[model samples]
Target: MAVYTVAQVKINDGERYEKYRERFGAVLQQYDGRLVAADDNPVVQEGQWSYEKIVILEFADLDAFNAFADSESYREIAAHRHAGADSLILVAKGR
Candidate 1:
């Protein structure tokens, strides 16, 4: 089964966040990740969730997802993101 990582982020520093974005894209590519959704505009249609950005990344399976998420490249960029924004990440196994 495939796996997905869903992230909701609220960026505090746009300039710094851009650097994280660039680095994150490189990490994703290295792990053969496919971005299913990456958008900043989100309509609050049903929930109380107010997020600045929403991202969904799909991987071959749970193991692949782990390899990418736990990689040093991702951790380095993740630190930048932690300093630049508030991020909520969730990982799920696709049915």
Candidate 2:
């Protein structure tokens, strides 16, 4: 089954966050992950949204997603994201 990674981020440093964003696509592509959506100003139809940005990623499967997320290379790159923003990241099994 396909899986999705949803991330809601509040950026502390735009320059640093841009660095993370720029490098992310290359890493994601290696794992067959695709960027589904990314928005800085999301339209909230109902409840409040506290985050400044939202990013959605789609992967071939749970295992693929896990492999990408758990890889040492990704972990090293993710440090930039961690340092640049406060984020809530979740994984969901797609229907």
Candidate 3:
């Protein structure tokens, strides 16, 4: 089964966040993951949306997603994102 990672983020520092963004793709590719969607301004059809950005990532399976997320390399790069923004990230199983 495929898995999806959904991230809602509010950036505090753009320059620092760029550092994280720049390295994200290469790291994701290592785990058979792909960026599905990334939006700075997403259309709100219903409830309140508090995030400044939204990102969706698709992976071959939960294990692949977990491997990418839990890797030491990713943890190191993720520090930049953590320092640059406030975010809510979640993983969901694809139907």
Highest lDDT model number: 3
Candidate 2 off by > 4 Å:
none
Query: What is model 2's C-alpha RMSD?
Result: 0.9
Give the candidate order by descending lDDT: 3, 2, 1
* Two-way TM-score contest, 1 vs 2, winner: 2
- Which order, best to worst by TM-score? 3, 2, 1
Worst 10 residues of 3 by lDDT: 24-33
- Count clashing residue pairs per candidate: 0, 0, 0
Q: What is the C-alpha lDDT of each candidate?
A: 0.90, 0.92, 0.93
Compared with the true structure, model 2 gives a TM-score of: 0.95
Instruction: Report the Cα lDDT for residue 81, model 1.
Output: 89
lDDT of 3 by residue, 5-82 (tens): 899999999988999999998998888899999999989889998898999999999888889999998998899999
Provide the global lDDT of candidate 3 against the true structure: 0.93
Candidate 2 minimal-lDDT segment of 10 residues = 13-22
Q: Native-vs-model 2 lDDT?
A: 0.92
Clashing pairs in 2: none
